[model samples]
Target: HQRLLCEIFNEICIPDLRSNINVDRILTLRRQVDALKIHRETFEKDLNELEDKHIDKKRKFLELNEKFHNEYAD
Candidate 1:
C-alpha cells in the first residue's frame, strides 16, 4: 500500500512541485532585475557628474587660453 500511495503522489503532485520551482525562479529573476535597475541609475548619475566636471574644466581652460593670448599677442 505504501508503494501504491507513493506512486499516486508522484503522479498527482509533480505538477505542483514544478510550479513551486518556477515561482521561486521568477522571484529570483525579479530581484536581479531590481538590482540591475539600481546599478544603472547609479552609473548614469556618476557619468553625468563626470561630464559636468569635464565641461567646467574645459570652460576654464578656454578662458585662460584666451586671456593669455590677449595679454601676450605679438
Candidate 2:
C-alpha cells in the first residue's frame, strides 16, 4: 500500500504542476499580442495624419513659387 501511494502521488502532482505553468505562459503571451495590436493601430493613425500634412505643405509651396516667378518675369 505504501509503495502504491507514493507512485500515484508522484505521477499526479508533478503533471498537475506542469500544466499550471503552461497555462500561465499562455496568458502572458495573449497579453503581449493585445499590446502589439494596439501599438500598430496608433502608428497607422499617426502615419495618415503626417501624410495629409505633407501634401498640404507641398501644394502651398508650389502655388507660392508659381506666383513669384510670374510677377518677376513680367
Candidate 3:
C-alpha cells in the first residue's frame, strides 16, 4: 500500500506541485520588480520638484529682503 501510494504521488502529484511553485515564484517576483521600479520613479520626481520649490522660495525671499532694507535705508 505504501509503495503504491508513493508511486501514485510521484507520478501524479509531483509535476502539479512543482509547476504551481514555479508559477507562484515567477508571479511574485514580477510584481515586486514592477512595484520597485514605479516607486523609484515617483520618489525621483518628488525629489526634483521639492528642490525646485526650495530654490524658488529662497530666491524670492532674498529679493524681498533686499528690497525692504534698501527702501527703509533710503
Best by lDDT: 3
Count of steric clashes across candidates, in order: 0, 0, 0
Can you write out model 1's per-residue Cα lDDT over 1-74, one digit (the tens) per residue?
A: 99988897775644555455667889999999999999999999999999999999999999999999999995
Colliding residue pairs in candidate 3:
none
Model 3 agreement with the true structure over 1-74: per-residue lDDT tens digits: 99988897785644465455667889999999999999999999999999999999999999999999999999
Model 2: per-residue lDDT, tens digit, 35-59? 9999999999999999999999999
Assess each prediction's global lDDT (C-alpha) against the native. 0.90, 0.90, 0.91
Q: State which candidate, 2 or 3, has the greater TM-score.
A: 2
Show the lowest summed lDDT stretch of 10 residues, model 2.
11-20
Per-model TM-score on C-alpha atoms:
0.70, 0.66, 0.64
Give the CA lDDT, 0 to 100, for residue 55 in model 3: 100
Candidate 1 global CA lDDT score: 0.90
Ranking of models by TM-score? 1, 2, 3
Q: What TM-score does candidate 3 reach?
A: 0.64
15 in model 2: Cα distance from truth in Å? Answer: 13
- Measured over all alpha carbons after superposition, the RMSD of each candidate to the real structure, in angstroms, is 7.4, 7.6, 6.8
